[model samples]
Every structure is written in C-alpha cells, then in structure tokens.
Target chain A: MIKATNLTKQYDNGFVAVDSLNLQVNKGDIYGFLGPNGAGKTTTIRMLNGLIEPSDGSVTIEEKEVKSENALVSKLIGVLPESHGYYNWMTGREYLKLFAELYGVDKKRIKSRVEEVLEWVGMAGKADILIGQYSRGMRQRIGIAKTIVHEPSIIFLDEPTLGLDPQGQKDIQSIITRLNQEQNVTVFITSHLLKEISEICNRVAIVKQGKLLEEGYLDELIKGYRLVLRNENPTLEDIFFSLTTDEVGGSI
Target chain B: MSSLIKKEIREHVFSRKGVWIFFAISILFSGLTYSFISVKELSLLAQVEVNMTFMKALIGISILVSIILGSTMVSGEREQGTLESLLLTPLSKVKIILSKVVGILVFWLIISVISIPYFYALTYGTNMLLTILSYLYLIGLPLVISFSLLSLAFSTWISSSKNATLLSIVLFLVTAIPMFLSTTMKKSGFAHLVDLLSPVSASMLTLKDWLVNRLGFFFIFMDSLPVLCFLAISIICLFYASKKMDFLGGE
Candidate 1:
C-alpha cells in the first residue's frame, strides 16, 4: 500500500511543483498519474521513489516512512523512467545482472533471472549486444527488463511507451498488464497518453499546475463526465476540457 | 550497492576507452624509459632523475584519467536520461555515488598495476621495489583521491556533460599551472606560493623526491593527509548534492 499525505515539494526558486497532495494506492491496482507538461506528476513520482526530498510533506509505503536513503523501498519498487540512460558499454544481459545484484538475488539465480527477464521482454536474442548499438525500441524493452529484474511488489513507469513504434507500444502495454494482473504488482504509471490510461488504468488522478483536479476509479470519472454530456452531446475529450476549464476558472 | 559497484566496474574497466587508456599509458612510460636508457652520456644520478621524470609523467596521466572518468560519471547519466531511471530504482543516492567512485577507483588501480611490469622492465636491476611500492601506496592513493574528489565536486555543480568536461579540463589546467610555473621558475616567490597552495604541485614534489631518494615520514604524512581530506570532502559534497537534487524543477 502507498500513502501520501499533504505532500508538498517547493524548489529553491520558489516554484511549488507538488502542492499539499494526498493520495493512496492499494495493492494490485494500476494507477495512472495524469498531468500537463509542468504538473507535479513527475515530482510526486520522484518523491515516492525517494529520489528527491519533499519540502513539507510525507509519504509512506506499506506503512514505512519514505526516508532519504531507504534501500528496502527501492527493493520493493521497480521504476521505468520516461527516458532511461544505461551504460552504453554493457551488454543487455550484463546491465540486467547489475541490478539483480543490487536487489540481492542469490548469486546462482542471477544468470537465469536475467535470461528470464530478457526473454520475457523479448530481448533475449539481443542480450549480448552492447546497449549503445540498440534501437530506441530495443532500449525501451531492455529498460523494462531492468526494472522488473528485482521482482518488486510495486512498479512505477514514467512514460514507458514514449517514442516507440506501434508494435513496441503494444509489446510494453501487454507486459504492463501482465505484471499488474498476473504478478499482482501495484503499478503507478505516469503518462501524457490519456488514451492508453483510459484503456488500461483502473484508477487515475488528473493533476494541473501542481494541484489535483480529480481522482477516482476511471469508470467513475468517465460516468460523471458522461452525465454532464447527456444534455450537450460532448465527446469524452470535450468533457475533459470542460472539467479542467471549470477547475481553472473557479480556482483562478 | 554492491550490485551497482559490480556493474560500474564491468562497464568502466572492460570498455574500449579503459583498455586503450591503459595500453597508451604503458607505451608512454616504456618509450620514455627506453629512450633514456639508450643515452650513454648520462651519469647514474642523471639516469635516476630521468626515471623520476617518467614516474612524475605517470602520476599526471593518472590524474587526467580520473578527471575524465569522474566528470562523466553523473553528467553523462543525466545526458542519456538514465539518471531518472536509476533514481527510480530502490537504490539510494549515496549508494549510486559510492558505487561510481568505487568503480572508477578500481579502474584506476588496474591501470596503475599494469604500469608496474613495464616499470620493472625499464628500471631492470635497480632496488626500485621500495620506490615503486611507496609510489603506489603513498602517491597513488592521494592522487586518486584528489582527482576523484575534484571531478565529483565539478560534476555536482554542473548539469551539462559538455560543460562538465570543459570545466574539468579548465580546473585540471588551473591546478597544474602553479606546478608548471614553479618548475620553470625554480625557487621564485610565485613558485613557492604555487607549490604550497596547489595539491597537484605538492603531489608532484613528493613524487619527484620519492623517486630519487627515500622520502621522510613528515613529507609523506603531509602529502597524504590533504588527499585523504579531499576524499572525505568529496563524500560530504556528494551527500549534500544528493539531498539537494530536485527532479521537479529544472534550470
């Protein structure tokens, strides 16, 4: 279980990226974190992963406070950043093996685990090739493999489908669904791709300008929007615009 | 952390640049030493001086390599957008920093070790074991610390890899300028001040003296202390930087 209470992150330049946000993510739920370009989605994710400190708030994963250096939290969480940078010199197998060690898997199991994850991600054939030689799609596949190598209970994917071909996007989407359903992993994914979220995520939180606009079960949000559209013949996209605009105008 | 450290070593030590740099340093030292040996007009003291000069060259080369490796450590990760990915993992910032330092240090040790056989072949029958060991234990440790710390410090301040590289080079030159001037001017006041203030100059001085004759404990102690301090400072600075890292706001 993930719980965030009044989480706030303020920069030295006085920009508040995440404002007094509160949230909870239970086990086995695929949660989507949605926001505009500069919304605090990434910041909130960073804080949850313990990458950066929150200015005036707190986060607890499985009832444990997210400290500055909590290795245990890292052990239980797998993260796929929107853009992944790896050591170009290493082969895919070698790169995955590195994370496996950090995750403290048994030494004998490292090789098999690496192979399994690589094969699962469909990059087994290219496992021996240097990462520098990989295509963008191939890199993304390997990035996902690295994240799952530890078999974390929770997974955080930051725009995991960005810049991929349609086929690559399909492959990742399927993998994410399997991980959440079969493995029962709690997934907290952030993306600009609302369509993808609408299709896969069970719940979503729409954030704008460091504030939460609305959050709940996806079906509920869509239903609420549909009720408004009954009198006006508006598409889901139109409903989204209206809801966001209403929040903006009222808050301003 | 151990896993990250292992990965760092595998990526860094086995890479093309790592191998090439090692081979290049070996060739450089061997060629300079062999050329000196071929000259028959030099006295025994002059031969020792020549060997000492080559050792100094090795020290400088190692420092350069450390800076090159250290500056690219984090900035390169940022450039590739991997910093975010790594940060997402359960790994803490301190683990990442320590793993990086350890990996780079291991590479430096390997390069230093490879130079040993070449030095032995060149010096051939002189009682150079003591000098070599001293250089390895005393001069080498401090040299690695100084360069690693300097590079880490620079990396923390700059986000751009290109800018980090440029800054590292500039800082290297600035640090070395005093020693260069001191050597060229001999016992002048400016040289004295430079020799006192610059770690590189002090290191060169200690290394040069050690190569020619047995160095006193006081000189070795004084020389080694500053480098150790630099290493500690680097750790502290990295911790502080990790604390200050804000992914939400970009400059």
Candidate 2:
C-alpha cells in the first residue's frame, strides 16, 4: 500500500512538475498511472520511489515515509525505471547477483535467488551470457529479474512494454499478472498505452500536467465516465478522454 | 559495501585496459631496473641509490590508475543510466563513496604487489627496501587516497566522464604547478604553503635529503605533512560531494 498527500515538486526555474498531487495505490493491486509526455508522471514516480525529494507534501509506503530514510523503504520495493540500464559487461546471472547483494540478500542464498529470479523472468537459459550479447527483450527481462531479485513486496514498473514486440509485451503482461495474483505483489505501473492499462490494471489514475483528474477502480471509473457519455461500454481510452485534457506539460 | 567494492575491483581486474596498463608499466619498470643494475661502472650499492626514483615511479603509476577509476565511477554510472538504480538501493552515500575509495585503492594495491619482487631485486644489499616499504605506507597510501577522493569529487560534480578526466588532469597540474614555480618565486606565503602542502614537492625534497643530506625518520615524517594535508582536504571534498552534489551528476 502507498499514499501520497499533497505531493508537489517545483524547479528553481519556476517550473512545476507535480503540483500538490494526491494519489493512493492499494495493496496487491495493479494500479495504472496514465499520462502523456512530460505530464509529470515520471517526476511523480521519481518522488514516490525515493529518487528525488518533493518540494512539499509527502509519500508513504506500508506506513513508511518514502522521503526520509527511503533507503529502508527501498528494501520492500523493487523498481524498473523507464530507461533501465544494465551493466553490459556483466552476465545476466552476475548482474542479478550484484543487485542481490545490494538488496542485502544473504551471500549463501545469492546463487539460488539469482537463478530463481532469472527463471521467473524466463532468462534462465541465457543467464550465463553477457548482457551486451542479449536482445533488447532479453535485456528487459533481465532488468526485471534484477528488480525483483530480492522478492520485494511492491514493484514499480515504468513503461514495461515499451519497444517490445507483441509477443514480448504479452509475455511481460503475463509476468505482471503472475506477480499480482500468485505472489500478491502490489504493481504500480505507468504507461501511455490505454489498451495495456485496460487489459491489466484493476485500478487507474488519470493525470495531466501533474494534476490528478480521476482515480478509482477500473469498473467504477468506466461507470462514472459513461454517465457523461453515450457509450454504454466505455473503454479505458474513453474514460481517459472524459477525465483528462489533451494538453501536455508546458501549457499547464 | 564490501560487495560494491568487490564488484568494482572485479570490473577493473577483468578489464583488458587495466591488464595492459599494469603489465606495460611492469615491463617498463623491469627494463629500467635491469638497465640501471647492469651498468658495469656502477657498484651494486650505487644502483640501490635509485630506490627513491623507483618508488616515485610506483607512486605516480598507482595514483594515475586510481584517479582514472575514481574520476569515472559516478559519471560512468550516470551515463549508463545505472546511477538511479544505485541511488535507489538501501546503501547510504557514505557507504557508496567509501566503497569506491576502497575499490580504487585495492586495484592500486594489486598493482603494487606485482612490483614488489622487481623492487626487491633493485634494492638488494641495502636499506633501500625498508625505505620503500615505509614510504609505501606513509607516502603511497595517503597520496593515492588523496588523488582518489579528489577525482571522486570531479566525478560527482561533472556529468561527463571525459570532462571529469580532463578536470582531474588539470587538478593534478594545479597541485604540481606551485612546486614548480616556487624555485623562481621567493619564500612568500604561497611558496611556503606549497612547501608544506605539496606531496610532489615534498617527495622531491625528501629524496634530495636522502641522497645529498642525511634524511632521518623524524625528518621523513615531518616532510610528509603534505600527504596528511591533502588527505584531510580530500576527506572534506568527499563529504561535500556526497552530501551536496547531485548524485545524478551533471554538466
């Protein structure tokens, strides 16, 4: 579970990235955070994930504040940033092992944990190969493997399906579902793809220009948005259109 | 912290560039030692007199390698987009910075270990080997740590590793220039400061004392204050960079 209260970020140049935005992600739910380019989505995520400090307000995960001593908060969370970078000189297994150590996984169990995560991400076969030799999809899977190597309870995945083929996207989506259903891990995902959110996320929050426009369970969001529209069966895209503006970051 | 240090050490050890640099220096050291010892007109004791020169060479090479690693560590991580992943981890900045310091020193330690036999042969039948060992700890350790921290400051402050490297080279010259100019400048506060706080200058002074004047252990410790001064300044710089500079690194 996570909570953000009046969370805001402002730059020295008088630009506001996230402006007093409030958000909540429930336990074990696939929560989708939808926004367009520079919509302050990534900035909000960065604040929540403890990469940057917010100018105001606060975020807490599992009752722990993400800003103060979030390194401790990081112990319970795994993150796959939008532009995940792998150590190209390292083997997939080696990379997993390195993160395993960073996450304070026991040295004795590192080998098993590395293997298990690699297997979970379907990278076990290529675990011995250098990441530089891996395909983009393979690298993405290995990135996910490293993210969850310590079995964190909450996983934040940014644009998990970006640049992937249909099959690769399906495979990643399946893994997301498995993590939610089988492992009972909270999935916080961000994406521009409305269809992907509709297919996977149980709850959704739509934001534009760092401001939250709408948030609720997918069914409730659809029902609420449908009341304003004639479409009986509202798609996520339809709900998004009804709730948020087309204007992006600069105008706001 | 140990894991991070080990990871960094493994990277350097496995790198082809590191291997070539280490051995190339070693081969050059061997050639220099053999040539000096093989001079028919020079006595074995006279050959051992070059101990200070060989020790200087080792210190210089070690600092060079350590600075390269330290100056690139943060910027390289940022460039590869791995810095966020690292900053997101549970490790503190102190732990990260200290581990990098230890990592670079460990690499230098390995390189220094490989030079021991060559140095021992060069100093056979003299008190020079003992001098080398003493200076290696007193002079070598602090000197390398100072350079490593200074380079780390550059790495944290500069987003581009190339620029960090350039700045480190410039810094190297900045520290060395005062000593060079002091020969012409009178004993001003500036010249006195360089005399007190420049390791390169102290090194030249110490070696001169050993060869021409009688340099005792007391004088050696006193002359090495520059090493301690640089080490203290480097500590301040490291602390500042860790707390104030952006971990994401930038231009």
- Considering every candidate listed, which one attains the maximal lDDT? 2
Pairs of colliding residues, candidate 2: none
Please report, in order, the local distance difference test score of every candidate based on alpha carbons.
0.76, 0.82
Tell me the tens digit of each residue's lDDT in model 2 across B57-82: 78777777778888998888888888
Candidate 2 lDDT score at position B166: 85
Q: Top TM-score: which candidate number? A: 2
Please write out the lDDT profile of model 2 over residues A31-138, one tens digit for every residue: 999986777888888899888889999999999999775878999999999987878988988888889999999889999989888878898899999999998889
Docking class of 1: medium
* DockQ for all models: 0.61, 0.77
Candidate 2 local accuracy as lDDT? Answer: 0.82
Candidate 2 runs further than 4 Å off: A242-252, B37-49, B178-182, B185-196, B210-212, B245-247
Predicted candidate 1 versus true structure: per-residue lDDT over A1-252, tens digit per residue: 888999999988999999999999999989999877788888898888777789988888877787743677888888887656877878999889887886777899999999999988899999999999999889988988998898888888999998888888888888899888888989999877777887789988888788888888887777777676673343334545565555446422
List candidate 1 segments past 4 Å from native: A231-236, A245-252, B39-45, B182-191, B207-216, B219-251
